[model samples]
Target: MSTTAERDPGKTQAWGAHAPTGLAGWVIRICHALPGTSRIWYRLTRLLRGPIKRAPVRPFDVNALGMELRLLNRGNFCEMTALYAPQFYDVPELDWLAAQLADGGTFVDIGGNIGLYSLAMAHRLGSRISIHTVEPDAELSARMRFNAEHNGLSINLAPVALSDHEGIATLKIDARQRGQNSLQDGTANGQADTREVPVNTLLALCQSRDITRIRAMKIDVEGHEPRILGHFFDNAPETLWPEALLIEHVHDDNRLMQRLIDALGYVEQGRTSRNLLLSRASTTGG
Candidate 1:
């Protein structure tokens, strides 16, 4: 018999939880001093588990980095990162993204997942900055919504997948790791363990939302970064390209992605364990 981490409500081990480190870890300790109501919500979700078979949610609110965020214990990256103080999540990437953004600018998170990046950026840069978080997974999107509301943060939530084309696509959900879900064409199509999600090209989303300026963007779409960005490059108006970008670099198309970014005049500035920080040449001082 196979173990049931996916189907069992009692799965409790965060086998790969975040081991907070460095100066970021110190900041996490400082921000850990705030109060949250997630304790009540977690017990509530646990009571609902017997009826639902699997508890789809577990509330985790940690006040860190000057903001409070509601998180979900979903047996994925959230377990690995967001459960800890936000500072410990991705120190370098978090700092880089925050520094590149301005107070009144706009930011887009293509695979917003549980809204950690959105929370971090908004908290660090100030609430005046408009943020749009895009996450296609039904469960994760729900968590994103809950977190945003609990933190008293206002942000645009795009509950659809982003793709090279506009329309519907099957999102392949990982049975165990929630963060591993993907809408890429290379993934299995129309399988039983999938959900058909609405998708829109980047250009279409901006136009529909009446967004004219995108100051910075952080994209981590599992393995589909190339396709998402390919669509952006092909369709986005030149004047609308984000001045700063933080893209996941550990994908199959790393080389191709580098070439495409270079062609668009982006210069590699730094990198974290899972991402490459890039800034457009036009945005730099002459």
Candidate 2:
């Protein structure tokens, strides 16, 4: 049961050494100051892919949510967006989650891209709480390990995807945008590479950690949200459910999942631009 930090002992030291410099540093500072500039920078990078690809400084270090993040600006969309607009990145959702788990408990991050949410919670709650981050992407998981180590945070990292059934599943990797990588088929908008990743059920994951209750959980598994969540709610007991749930509902057009959550005694707290916030009625007095 070796931890992610234990497995990659040198990644933090190696990657954390590089920081943005010169023109890149200046541009990054501007983007951080004016969040809107991040979109312009992203578009410009997309337009001038050849030149940006050959740029010397690709990975830039930034302090985000009290954690030091070494972001790769070229392929990963999450890192690039956070690199510039860290302040505004999921501010509302993160705030809501923090408030919900203020007393300290287990927090699970499903489809954790580079451990932003998990790292943020770890930094905020400290050793009073346990954090578990599940990510199937090899590179992103490695980066997440580096980030946790660099920030001096302890988190349980599970490098496995969660689905309705347990086995190997095809994860479609969006080459141009790593954040768009998904387990759902035919969801890729651009050129996608596929890889076979190990899959497990959410209940099994919790059981493996001996977790009986969860304070909050954030799940952003692209289009595969319904499959994972539906199965979990159907099989898991109410005590095992998270008191607060932040689910990415951008791809859920029919809102079937919302109805399912409501039927399971979870009331909608609110909605952000990309996620729907829900809390259990018994726990939150909904």
Candidate 3:
């Protein structure tokens, strides 16, 4: 089977060359000709920025899978096309999430980035599900807030990095990759610029919100995923554990991560090259 990176060129490659300057571009041009859409089209073009990492960030919206997501695509070429013109989001994981989360179910998004997972869940599942999204970037968090409110979705936003410990930690950011920020020493130990951001363990987050019964969870915190999850699975009660999970597994540490989840009685259900989906052994598969 093809990897997620292979299935979606935009996921890892610069899409400016393969993108529909052909058919997709033609349809976008047609949309521009329609009344009241010209402005949006123009803004969308600005958002699909070039390969300059220092370029000004541009905020725009694009419909993907089933959600209309707000994005800041500029300055990151790979993320721009992937998030904006996305060939396809994580279909397998998304399918599992949709099948598992019933109305009134609870979902948690760690390292929410721009809250694409949250928006997609709310759009597909409606106001019945409560989504708690954790992200450390103030700007991206605000954009996520805008998308949730504009779409009339109920998403609780927490603007802090979820780590194994509480208090402040140095968050390392990729100058070129906005989604690659993390609290791991490998990512944070460099002389590359860092920021002291408040951190909280998943247990603390859930307790503060009185949130329990998490049906599903998605984690994508660069290299910090293992530590974040280690804290949860080791300490959180079985009731607080999610029945389904989507975690980015494209890391060197993921070999150990599998053992960690296995010890918690979770079984791997599916994979999408970039991520893995697991279902708890104690819970029935959706």
> Which candidate's lDDT is highest?
2
lDDT of 3 by residue, 101-129 (tens): 87468899988876777887888888778
lDDT of 2 by residue, 1-286 (tens): 3233323434646655657676667666665665434456546444433443345335667776666787765666667667766765777888888888888888999999888888888888888789999999887788888788877989899999898988887788775677888785332344347777888999999999899999899999887887888789899997898888899878896575657565877888889778888888887752
Stretches > 4 Å off in candidate 3: 1-56, 76-79, 82-84, 184-192, 252-254
Candidate 1 runs further than 4 Å off: 1-57, 184-190
Candidate 1 differs from the real structure by a C-alpha RMSD in angstroms, to one decimal, of 9.4
Q: Which lDDT tens digits does candidate 1 get at residues 31-75?
A: 443233444443433343232224444444445455555444455
lDDT for predicted candidate 1 compared with the true structure: 0.68
Query: What do the candidate models score in CA lDDT, each in turn?
Result: 0.68, 0.77, 0.67
Query: Each model's TM-score?
Result: 0.75, 0.84, 0.75
Off by over 4 Å in 2: 1-16, 35-57, 184-192
Clashing pairs in 2: none
lDDT of 1 at 217: 92
